[model samples]
Each structure stands twice: as C-alpha cells, then as structure tokens.
Target chain A: MPYPEELVSPMRAELTRLGVKELRTAAEVDGFANGQKGTALLVINSVCGCAAGGARPGVAMALEHGTKPDAVVTVFAGQDLDAVAKARALFAEYPPSSPSLALFKDGKVVHFVPRHQIEGRAPAMIANDLKAAFDKHCAKAS
Target chain B: MGTFHHDTHELHGITCVVETRGPRTWVGRVHEVGPAGVLLHDADVFDEVPGGPTKAEFLARTAAVGPWPRHKSVVVPAAEVTSVRRLGDLSA
Candidate 1:
C-alpha cells in the first residue's frame, strides 16, 4: 500500500529539507543524468528502520562536508519504480539495491553503497562512511 | 534468501516493482520496506485522492505482493528487483 498523502508530505519534506532532489519519474532520472554536467549522487530511498535510523541522516551529514557531489538526488524505492529502474541501468557493474547510494561522475558510476553497508549502524557511522567516499570522489571546486 | 538494503532516513520514499508468487506484478512506492513485509504505497490512478489513505490501506491489504511479513530489514533479494532508480534528489 502506498503511504497516505498526509503521511507522505512530511516524509518528502524531510528529504527535501536535507537537499535531496526527488526523481518522481523515469524521465526525471534521465534528465538528471543527461542534463546535469557533473557528478551526481543518486539515492534509492526506502522505508526501513535502518534507513530512518541511519541511511538518510547519514547521507545528510555526509553532504555537510566541503567536498560533495555537485547534485544529490533520490528516488523512493517502491514509489518510483520506473525512475529507480532507469537509475539502476546506469549502474551496470553492481546489482540492484534498495535504500542504496550510487555516486556518478560524468554519467558513470564511481561509487556504490550497497545494502550490506546500511544495515545495523548509527546514522553518524553511515555519515562518516559517506564523508569518506565524498572526500575521495566529490570534487573540491564548489 | 535475497538481500535488500534501505537507508534509515529515506524510508518513506522507496518504491519498487514487486513480483508475487504467481504471475502478478505491480508498481508501488514503499511505505515501509522492512524485514517482515514491504508496506507498499499502491498507485491508485482512479481515486479522488490519488495519494490518500486508500493507498496505505490497499498496501496493508494486498496479499499478492509478499512473502508474508519480513523479519529484519535487509538488502532486497536480487531476484525481486528487475532494476532500481532514484525518484529525485531534494535540493539542499
């Protein structure tokens, strides 16, 4: 069952407030990939205790650093099926993962955060890990 | 056993095209993607309130979409997903 609209607004607001762009359709995902000129971060959002407790907050904290993707975007796992599928196609090397994070540089996947990384961890811990990845991949330009 | 993962905070937005036991399939966003059972937000196009409580209610009632209650949220089984993508990123 989909979430009630009332319920979804608050949740969507949380991600928006954190600076995560919502890719509601496959075309949007494609536009992001093709239109964006630089590194983009794609997050597959999910409704799980670990995701609430760790993943989203962790990604938010990680983006606080000096070096981060030029753009950060997300797709709700079960909600935006086509968009999610399109994004996964970009990740040719890795298998599909929900509640996962993928970093692309110039339209190519450079980093991937699989499900194994999200389970059973503190948000801070996940943030730190993401920060590390950001530091390595995200350009220090803007 | 298939493994699936979900970020703790982005729990509300995840969606997937789930395949059931027989030859059934549907696309819906996840209200709660846990170990017990994925709480899907069914996309009802005809409803007056396209994104209303009916969506949640339908998810709660749908039987063709699950293995019946998950245990501890983990990585989605690779077999369950045909693909994965981002809906959009919220602007920071």
Candidate 2:
C-alpha cells in the first residue's frame, strides 16, 4: 500500500518549493531518465522516518548553494508506484535504494546518495556531500 | 554576442538537446545545468547513437524525417554528456 496523499502532499511541496520537479508517472520518469543532456538531480522520495529527517531537508539545503543541479525532480516511492518503478529502472546499473539521491550529468551517473547514506546521517552532512559534487561537476560548460 | 558562453547558470529554463556518451539522448527545456547535473522540463529521451555498432544516428535521421518525441519530462544525470545544442527557443 502507498502512503496517503494527504500525508505526503506537504513533503512533495517541500522539494517543489525549492524548484524540484515532481515526477508523478512512469512516462515522467522515463522522459527524464532517457536522454537527459546535462546534470539532473533525481530523488527517490519515500515516507520513511529518515526521509523526513535527512533526505528532504538535506536536499533543500543542498540546492541553496550557488552551484547546484540544473534541474531537481522527485518520484515518491510508495505513492507514485509506476513512476517510482520507472525511476528505479533507470538505475538498473546501480543497486535499488529508495530515499536515495542520484545526480547525473550529460545523462551519466555522477554522484549517488543511497538510502544507507541517509539512514543515519545529518541533513547538513548530506547537504555538504551534494554541494561537493556540485562544485566539481556543475562548472560552467565550455 | 560572439563572446557568449554557455555558462552553467545560464542554461536555466530553456529548451535544448543534451547528447551524451551512453544510450540516452535527452531533449527538453533545460531547467538548470548546475555543478551536479542538468534539470529539465518536458524532457524526452532518444537513443544515443553509440560509437561503433549499436549507435543510432538520431538527430541526423530525425531531422530528415519529422519531429518525433521518445519520452517526456523526467530527470537523469549528466556525467556522460558530450555536447549540448539549442534545438529551439523557449516561449516567453
């Protein structure tokens, strides 16, 4: 069963408010994953307690940095079933992990923060990790 | 301007084609091309024509044929991107 939409609505908006796009369908996930040109941040949003604690807040803080992903998007794991599945398929190369963060550049995997990384970490630490990747890969394209 | 640079920050909210190294070729309005990855809206993925055997000549062939879309608005990464090109202008 999926988490109630009412329960997750505010969580969804949390990321969207920071400009993260919510991918609500399988097609949406496929469209984003298939041929992306530059960097993208794909978050597998979940309803776990840790998600609220670390992933969500961490991502929001990470995006505040001067250098960040060109686009931010998310697919709720339990609620957006097909969308979440499709998103996972894109990560077929990597192990499946929800409440995860995958950053891509030019359609290739660059930085990944899996569930394990978030399960027992601080939002600030997570934010720092994402910021580090931004500094390295988000350089202006020549 | 002749000195125009495709600054990473400048790519926010515009449509373009992102050609990369692997099997994915993305097309959509660029949401952002930040240090981590590019975010896009109404994005679609076409097969990335590969190096020797499995590559499909997509844009070249598609341009000759007609406007066809493979996928739409989703998010991925940019670690393998090789090039970015302007396909059209975003509506103002």
Query: Which parts of model 1 are misplaced by more than 4 Å?
Result: B1-92
Model 2 chain A weakest lDDT span, ten residues long: A112-121
Candidate 1 residue lDDT tens string, A1-142: 5555564566556677987899989999888887556788888877655567667778888888888888999887766679888887888556465677888888888777665456556778878877777788778865
Write model 2 residue lDDT over A82-112, tens digit each, in one string. Answer: 9988887876665455578988898887887
Question: Best by DockQ, which number?
Answer: 1
lDDT of 2 at A73: 91
Position B2, candidate 2: lDDT = 8
Q: With candidate 2 superimposed using the best TM-score fit, by how many Å does residue A135's alpha carbon deviate from the native?
A: 1.0
RMSD of 2: 18.2
Error of 1 at A102 (Å): 0.5
CA RMSD of all predictions? 14.3, 18.2
